[model samples]
Target: MPKGKRKGKFEHRRTEEKIYSSDEDAGIDMTIDNCSETSGQSDLKSAHDDAENEQEKLEEKVLEMIDALSARSNAARAGAMVSLRNALQRRHLAAVLCNQRATLADHLAKALRRGRDGERRAAAGLAPLLALQIGEEGVEEFVNEIRPELAAAAADKSASLETRTEVMSQTFTYV
Candidate 1:
């Protein structure tokens, strides 16, 4: 057989050649052909399974971090809250967190109310992201639950301006 040619059962024949006007056209054609080869239902199912597995792992990690919020070391607790806040940025993770919004919010609120300065700051930062993850109705409920405490904290002259501002902005503005 000649180069770039194939033999059939009956006889040897020239393969049809595709002509492209530009390298970009050639690239597009190659992409289309490659895509067709991998566009089977199995490929889609496998991709979906992978996505679900990743989501599960992410959810597990977020839960672990939330548990870590109660660690004896302030640094560990602050780190966990920060991690939870970062995880909330992912929509899938956020949805998972939202499922436990009441528990999460209550825990963070306690931290904001009674923890040391660093823990309070971490809780302050995570509060808005938690509200956003829980959606409008959930956020409204959270705000209602914490509104009085937040107002008290905001008005308390002893509280640092940053802490008061965090409480007011995160609770009221976001809700």
Candidate 2:
């Protein structure tokens, strides 16, 4: 008897020996010749890359809107300011804006000092949120760089009392 056929009462489950010239001949599925790679992993990587690209485009658009705050048209500037406020509501977007704190502070300071009433109010509202997002270091930088303009705005007789009050409150909070 063959070695596989020698079993009696305790017969081996695989009593028949299989000879294979190829994997398919031995009843093996050869679809996945390489087990190291997975289709799901590639799909996940592609999705992640797409998300990153979309995020980058959004950041660029936000920066362009920030620059638009200096537009000559009051309507245009107001629209841009509104867009920026909405964008900054997202924490990651706020962090990205905060990373360029110097430029942001400069633009905001300019808005506070020279922009129309709506723009000034928008800048005042955004300052605290920006400070909060960037934490202590950002607050310090904002105070050091933009404080004078804020002080000037607070004292500007042309500005609405409500706007001035808001600026003063933010200044005290940062200090």
Candidate 3:
């Protein structure tokens, strides 16, 4: 092709924006329409409110579970730990959980120190999850809160072999 023809083609390519004609050709709607802007803003606000409500509910449930941790029944405590572990695994509740780390760590330690094998195991399983939820800055604080009980549990031969192993393994998760 002649130089002039090549330059013209290049200029066209530079000036022309690619357009998708079909919905399948684009990932989102690219067309502009004079829809009411308030509708979009309202939708955004509604979504934000819904998310805040959901998060608040999750925090309340977790707090209830923490209270359950103090129940006299071993099964109740273990069940609470299991629920907490499942919840932490499913969602990141760092902001709420960070504030509760001390309470959570203390409850876990109490379970390890006094609860039966099953409860102890559940508490051990939850230790790392607490560390994770609290994030790096708080890991040391969390560990400090629970380390004594974890150490005692690890040394307690009366604890079931499985429970001891679980405790040992989870002890390494944050350390």
Candidate 4:
């Protein structure tokens, strides 16, 4: 996916099989669009093709991990996502990460649609990274997009405190 596509804030469901890119600048995105779902077959094919096209072992590893995460079990999916996101940034898979932005965003949007607690929190982490290249104003727009939900969420105790804290803190980042 292109970096520009994930700009601002958005939503997605978190899942073990979902593939999230680590290009997030500040964290989760808040942009809303009629994001469509893509086929698993295509995502699998894309990851496979990425591996074949890249000779760099490190880049290949990123693709390999993405493929692996795409099929991971739900019990381990959230942790797996965090690991993948961390790897994207920590391993510096800038080229592939930038290229996979669309796929990642699609998958993320789907995750948010799932409406699970874990998925939302995982999605939150991507907002910052999504708008990183777009600069602060974009980030502000992104944060403002999701602030209401975050604030309202903070008032609810059923969700994880991390979710509320992340969202509320996001308000500070944008405001």
Candidate 5:
């Protein structure tokens, strides 16, 4: 052996082969994974936000239909009732409408009392739908709110026989 040189088969091998350290590679991989995870979470959040926005638009439209029930024109009130019924059938608005059942009952009763034949018939048609949406618990409240007007409309001789019969049948269904 020389003064500065040591004999070893492994010592020469170390200089010839590349050394791999896991720390550097792991740091880069972890950063990439973190970025992807953050982006994925953001995408999910955006999707959730879009769904909530869509639900809000639906609820607003239903509320507008409810307000339209009070329109002065008989045709408009009848149209609103039909539209409201269509919307209810298309969407499950239980959560959105549960809070507004009383207001809905009031409008429906008023329509039954003061509206023309078509409007009263449409209003009568809507009672069962409202009861269905309000579920078992709040149905009594809705029934109570509208029952008097239902009774009046059912017995009103001036209304067409069809209207009175429809009102009577609807009243029986609810009671």
Candidate 6:
């Protein structure tokens, strides 16, 4: 990163130094050496770490929200859970998410079983994202796990129109 000139009292370099800690600095050396012209490594690492930490904090907050909020209140808990689960897309958490892929996938299906239309759509969407992290083949596993119940749910007019549509859409991809 360029170390010169700033418009303020604090040096721009010092401001940057504080953003990426030594751990991120050291971890990025290999990438920096190989691809020297890429965006500043420190800045990328800092952004990644900040994003991961924020997700973890948010997931913790969701767990708290889930426990504190009534389960019957689908909109509230579903919103929290959807955002919490979507963090699986990050590479840093890929292994952890992959390890929990079956559980996560299963719960996603169960959410369809128990969720409102919007929540069901959100949960069904998580399957493909989890499959990308786990493996393309896991899409079959996800489909096998969820299909029976969703088929039943789709038959039920009581099911959300959106949930029925999302479940139909998922069939084309995973099945």
The whole-model lDDT of each prediction reads: 0.72, 0.76, 0.87, 0.55, 0.88, 0.63
lDDT per residue (tens digit) for residues 81-147 in model 1: 9888777765545566657778877777677767766676678778777766777657778766656
Which residue runs does candidate 6 get wrong by more than 4 Å?
Answer: 1-73, 85-92, 136-140
**Candidate 6 weakest ten by summed lDDT:** 62-71
Write candidate 4's Cα lDDT for 64-172 as tens digits.
6555545445435455556666765654455666655555545444444443567556655654555463344344454445555545545656767776676556446
Clashes of 3: 0
Q: Sort every candidate by TM-score, greatest first.
A: 3, 5, 1, 2, 6, 4
lDDT of 2 by residue, 17-132 (tens): 56567767777877855544677688789999999999998889887987787688777876787787777776456557667788778878888888877778777777776666
User: What's model 3's overall lDDT?
Assistant: 0.87
Where does candidate 3 clash, by residue pair? none
Give the alpha carbon lDDT tens digit for every residue of 63-164 in model 6. 453353235666765775566555554333454454455666656666777777877777666656666666554656756777776666566588867778
Model 5 stretches with alpha carbons more than 4 Å out: 1-49
Supply candidate 3's per-residue lDDT for 145. Answer: 83
Q: List the residue pairs that clash in candidate 1.
A: none
lDDT, candidate 6, residue 67? 52
| lDDT value for model 2 | 0.76
* Positional deviation of residue 26's Cα in model 4 after best superposition, in angstroms: 63
Between candidates 1 and 6, the lDDT winner? 1
lDDT tens readout by residue for model 3, 36-141: 8999899899999999999899989988988888888999999999999999999998987888878888899889999899999999998888887898788888
Ranking by lDDT: 5, 3, 2, 1, 6, 4
Q: What value does the lDDT take at residue 172 in candidate 1? A: 68
